[model samples]
Target chain A: MNKRVGKQTIETPSKPRIIATASIVGPKEGEGPLKDYFDIILEDDLNGKDTYEKAESSMMYTAVNEVIKKANFKEENIDYLLAGDLLNQLTSACFAAKDMDIPFIGLFGACSTMTESLAMGSLMIDGGYANHVIAATSSHFSSAERQFRFPLEYGSQRPPTAQWTVTGSGAMLLGREGNFPYISYVTMGKVKDYGVNDVNNMGEAMAPAAVDTIAQHLRDTGRTPDYYDIIATGDLGKVGKRITKELLLEHGFELKDNYIDCGDEIFEHERQKTNSGGSGCGCSAVVDCGYIYKNMLNGKFKRVLLVSTGALLSSTSCFQGLNIPGIAHAVAVEI
Target chain B: MNKRVGKQTIETPSKPRIIATASIVGPKEGEGPLKDYFDIILEDDLNGKDTYEKAESSMMYTAVNEVIKKANFKEENIDYLLAGDLLNQLTSACFAAKDMDIPFIGLFGACSTMTESLAMGSLMIDGGYANHVIAATSSHFSSAERQFRFPLEYGSQRPPTAQWTVTGSGAMLLGREGNFPYISYVTMGKVKDYGVNDVNNMGEAMAPAAVDTIAQHLRDTGRTPDYYDIIATGDLGKVGKRITKELLLEHGFELKDNYIDCGDEIFEHERQKTNSGGSGCGCSAVVDCGYIYKNMLNGKFKRVLLVSTGALLSSTSCFQGLNIPGIAHAVAVEI
Candidate 1:
């Protein structure tokens, strides 16, 4: 059976199961609406570490370990660890991976790392590359701010379009044979540049890519929006969420009943003062692992489309006046 | 049929073929001994670009396009493009990927990205995920120096142990069916930290990882060093090459013959003034794609073990006094 469908999608002949998942967040995200769903909520963003980078690494280490523990497996049992973070050279992920004995592959999809890891893990399992793989990602608000934008000590005022970088980590353990939410299909995305260069407006930059991937997935799978109980985009905030909806509608598909943006829902915009909403790799990661996965297990949703969007640009590129390019990968999960 | 042999290795049931490969390098690399093997050699390191980052991106874009053309496939025929670079957030790779319409998966294995991409690309093809995939990576001396160490304007004298980052790019097109070098097996790597904190001596930091992966590959495949015509490590340079050989000897495996390090062979040490020799993601990449792959086609080597080593550490981690973690992945290529 040819697993590939249409152009950029792959339908797994043997669905890859998400055996277990874990999420860790800082006090800010813990105060969010989905606080009860997170496994570990830190009292401080630094988590007692000397630096924010070290703290982020510690969080990721905990998330990876927690996910493996929840799967009832030891460190040695995991065949591979696919992970990444927003920091330069994926500092958090590489540092966290150093503590584990699992063979590791480092990925970088910015915020889309959550679904990128999930999609790659699923493909690896279904392709017989591994029986079990751990997909994880982490992000720290302080670290990201210093690296991507302004320094924490600078006390810069963010634009209304700016999204808060979530300080958290998420991990999912995937297996070939398991009774869990099965990854059925994957739609890989092409880099799309909509001529948006403002780093502060990542949501606007990434929204088109989210819509592009969702539409491609739908077309490839021959399914309508109704086929999925929930349609989720990773970190596209309120502005990007609305833009995605409008783009979908323009394509003759309306996401009327089931639509969610992880960034938009992670926090209360007015109360939390997170500008547009939560962002970063951990934004969508914790939402999917802590909230969505839990609800799927509870039978609240039987089918879901996860479109994890990423704005792929560096500070150097932005400084060099290059347009921000966005990419989004979609994964179809069924219970 | 199980494909997986032993703990950390995967033996492809249907060996994926390297249908086509391309390499582009700067003037210094072109002046090297293996210059004859490279496809395109730029007259200058800048390659007429405003910045070294853009130059690196252009080199990668050209390499990818050339490989696809050599493979007799159009841009749309490519199923996926797996690429990365040493820059923060993989700017060169992501920027280069913007020109292509193929679905892109950005990876980061540092210098090991060359073999890591090949391993994943091979698995995707053998696992029936895609008929064709392209693995590519790039690195520029000026760009990597500015990002990882001092600015080019700093003009600080390099230590004797330091290696010159290669200014080059390499791309390989893998297909399910093709008359090319067959990818027979892959040995994934575990992150190994030896408490080496000196970011300048990446060779020493990454040597142990190369030895570890090579030992695991031998153990997993149940093969002796004699099985392979060439056992190569990517960008480990003279220091790392010696350390790797010494470590392998301590592990009861003697690479008595047919052992090579891509970094050691890429440049003429004395003439090039590259103290410890060439090092970077592109060092191994261009060597593998241009020199080794071409020689293999000409029957100079039958079976080879290509192990690409990486010292996974960010400048922030180094500044914060963290030990460098090393990783190396191996792929078996046969005629």
Candidate 2:
């Protein structure tokens, strides 16, 4: 009955089903490789809103509505909506939830919010606290750049290590009475800081945390890399992916063969000019909901370990010369 | 098996206990009426930190560690740490959790974080997800003022309606094995916006939301105001408390005698010069942990309803001229 498996993993006994999922991306992402997998593609990042922040909120609202439509359920059917975004105070998610009229719990895990919400939603359903829960997150390129980096009008040049923030949103509905792929396990993560302070290279900053969670998951669950058909990490771009693989190998878990970073899969690096890769709350969100979830439905993957990584550094903390702490949450899904 | 009551409340069949708690307050709060109740009263708000942000982080760290110590448990004994603060990106909570090495889940409910964390932690325990969970939140007057209002050096004058943000942190350790006050039910709230846009008068903006959740909780549980010995609203302050009481009376529930606002209990309004009383993430946190929890332990109150209200408007949203939305989550506790 003790669902906690070693240090940081929770073994889900009920295996709460992921009933439906939907992803919405901006025009840039629509032109990317996995464009067809997305449910809605915006021709403009603004999405008819005046500010990029409102545009991000619109994307979240759209994704939540689309996922509910896909599940053929009414808004009243959702018992709780757990959501978060990269914006300060989670403006996008909170604004979106305000219109939904559902019970809301705002979360903040930076880019890892997608998986954090999913893990919490699964537990809510599995624990019989709710019949259905919607977990959603969003990020916007312009909004994030303005908030975390520089002003949009500044047109400042970025270094090659900088990862482009993805403009998109993803929502997943979890329910107890579904025959869809179910979340089998969830591994929570501790804050791990490797003393990296460069805000520009978030991929490198988050890499070690992903490594820690990945190794911890395998060790706690007593599973090898081969046990999972695919192990996907959130937003650890090309640079971080290499570091993650090395660290996992150092930790004695050879995770290279079956592992893939969501950021690396989002765009064609050479042509898209997404220097390192896509990075944000939305980077891994759209990939997981559009690519991985769809593939699982098609029987392309039997088991998957989706670890969403986050850099827990605020602009204030960066300004104060604090080290960037990173965290990664892993959820095991089986069809 | 259905834990959900009429509409919004979750009736926990397996009640979760508040095993131990600790509160740390700044110099100002230490001079307040509830001074004797707080565990740690700092001689100065800075507490040897250069920045007020780091000072808030130190307060959070001290409260979390003190709560663990009070419970006679090490950091490893805690399965998860759920924390938040008024700082952007939850800098206080994240920085505190980084040093603890516990699995962290950062939440953002603005000022409602105290009850939000308590609700989530209780569900985690009752659901058999974890045996022990720590819920903590903090807010510093200087840090919150700089982020949400004027900078410390600005020395801007505030309106009479403006409330002072409390400088303090509170942590509660929830477990399944303790004989502490049990969490009996939780009511997750829906965002309610009455089109109030003034960031300066957050109490007025959040009042309707506290009314909505309190009424929904009473309706769903089929209980009257007198069903509990006390009903405490988080940080509605004097302005919000008055509005909330009127709104609840309009909804056919006259909650005048037994209801109290935590914001009203902290500082003496006239003597402390906190115009509209205390209002922040820390306002209700220290009040609940230090005063209410201590009183409950002494058998002063058998049953209570704690509703923590929040105004979910970021500085960005306010700058963008968006209306403020409010939410209030309620928890039923019984000794």
Candidate 3:
């Protein structure tokens, strides 16, 4: 187990560790054309419309398959599967986990699910429960829009801080440490509510939470930005990332070289009109399962910090003028 | 880890395990009332006009507090939390988990989340990852009703198969071993679509999934109904339970002395009101947490099978002409 740096030490299992991770999404929404496991499927009758469940499930299905293939295993070898998505019942993640035929466990943490899954899965491996564990998450715009915001056809003006729903999914595999890089550390994002009432622009509303989590990780680890090659937040696009940078400077620390955000990275190519950035579990997941995995495998970047974030507020709470509480988790991996 | 009937196969990390579980709904909306937890915060004039999110936040806040207190746990000692509720992005669960200041991993399994959480948490203990993991789930009538079917005040006519939501929350602790019983074996429920076209009543929609999972569990373990004191399902309600019983008999098994369904259990007080039975993750959860936990601690029942079921289709999917797929998970606990 890794030693503590600051107030409390974070320990990962010596037994069970995540060995591989993967993800997939629609062709048009994907970062690249061929960087997907299965062919991108879009139904004709539903123009530019996809259910959060479908978008989430299809990608999750692909991710699970990728992790399985990477490990060179069949369906039954996996003892259990843990998954969740941006649905009321975690249908996409759970349903996909079920079909995959692994003993399945489901979870939901809104956009922060991927990190949470990693934490649980990592702990499992550390504790020596099993040799392998899989975690995944996904989301879609069509499903979330109607359920959380408005009807599918409703054309409401989005607030500048409002983030576009990420249309994607990501998956990972954990096993005994051997050849692959291991998750050295994980810190959960503290729930910070600046009491900002306007969720139309989530980046501004969530910036403080992201900042707090990063700051805490730094304080807890007693490490500066030089400790890793890059620090990537789950979502938080340009505006949010800028605010985070500004906040970091205010605290007497700076991360100028590569303090990037995952949502901004994933949506860089498939720019769906949005003021701030993309937000969802898929933001980090897609990037992790896709770009991040490829890069790490290709020996592009070593020692990276992936801090996924989530906004904890529902439609009812939003309607009641409750402030959005944001949380993030930092996962450190070294090549 | 505990060994099953036939294999005599041993687990790597030896300890108690989480097995056969159940979740079922009663009349109250999402989950049933807990004896120790405060009475459901009835929506009155002050909160009556609250939005789905508002009522949900309030109820969730109250329920979580009660769950923590009842579990006799100080928030800090909780190594990790597994929680999920029915809402877009799991806003309610996230908000609560954040405020609790307990590092948590949120999850979503729709109504089957209770079982899913149990399965994952149990695996953690069985695999030697944790000594304590709390699995919790909740649902609210206003929240679910508004999101899927109608507004809280819609007062629409009820369908025959529409199971009542049991406005409640259920939580339990998974550990290496306890004075009370421990989760014995966890059998995952598969995503089975029986092609049932009925949507108005969830019993019709989810019955097949429950049956399939329970059948698979028995088949996989090679155990018979005579092995357990009870064979309970999460929230199939009266209608769904009846169908499940019929299916089980058709499979040449009879749970003669000790087979009671959770949905049917909660409604024993007000049979007429419960009508068919409970439906929702909280349905089975509340029963398990409020009723079953106490009984097991008191040594009323020894061996039991808890199978929580879920229908993985959403209102939009139904409208989109997609069939509702369902899943169930069974965890057995022995005192």
lDDT of 2 at B173: 96
lDDT digits (tens) for residues A252-299 of candidate 1:
889976999999999999999998888899998999999999999999
Candidate 1 lDDT score relative to the true structure: 0.92
Q: Could you tell me the TM-score of chain B in model 2?
A: 0.99
Q: What is the lDDT of residue B119 in candidate 2?
A: 96
Every candidate's DockQ is 0.78, 0.84, 0.31
Candidate 2 on B60-95: residue-level lDDT in tens? Answer: 999999999999999989999999987888999999
The regions of model 2 sitting more than 4 angstroms off are: none
lDDT of 1 by residue, B98-182 (tens): 8889999989999999999999998889888888999999999999999989988989898888999999999999987757899
Give the true-contact fraction for every prediction, in order: 0.73, 0.82, 0.41
**Superior candidate under TM-score, 2 versus 3:** 2
Ranking by DockQ: 2, 1, 3
Candidate 1 has a TM-score of 0.99
Task: Please report, as a residue range, the 10-residue window in candidate 2 chain B with the lowest summed lDDT.
Answer: B1-10
lDDT of all predictions? 0.92, 0.92, 0.66
Q: Which stretches of candidate 1 lie above 4 Å from their native place?
A: none
lDDT of 2: 0.92
Clashes of 1: 0
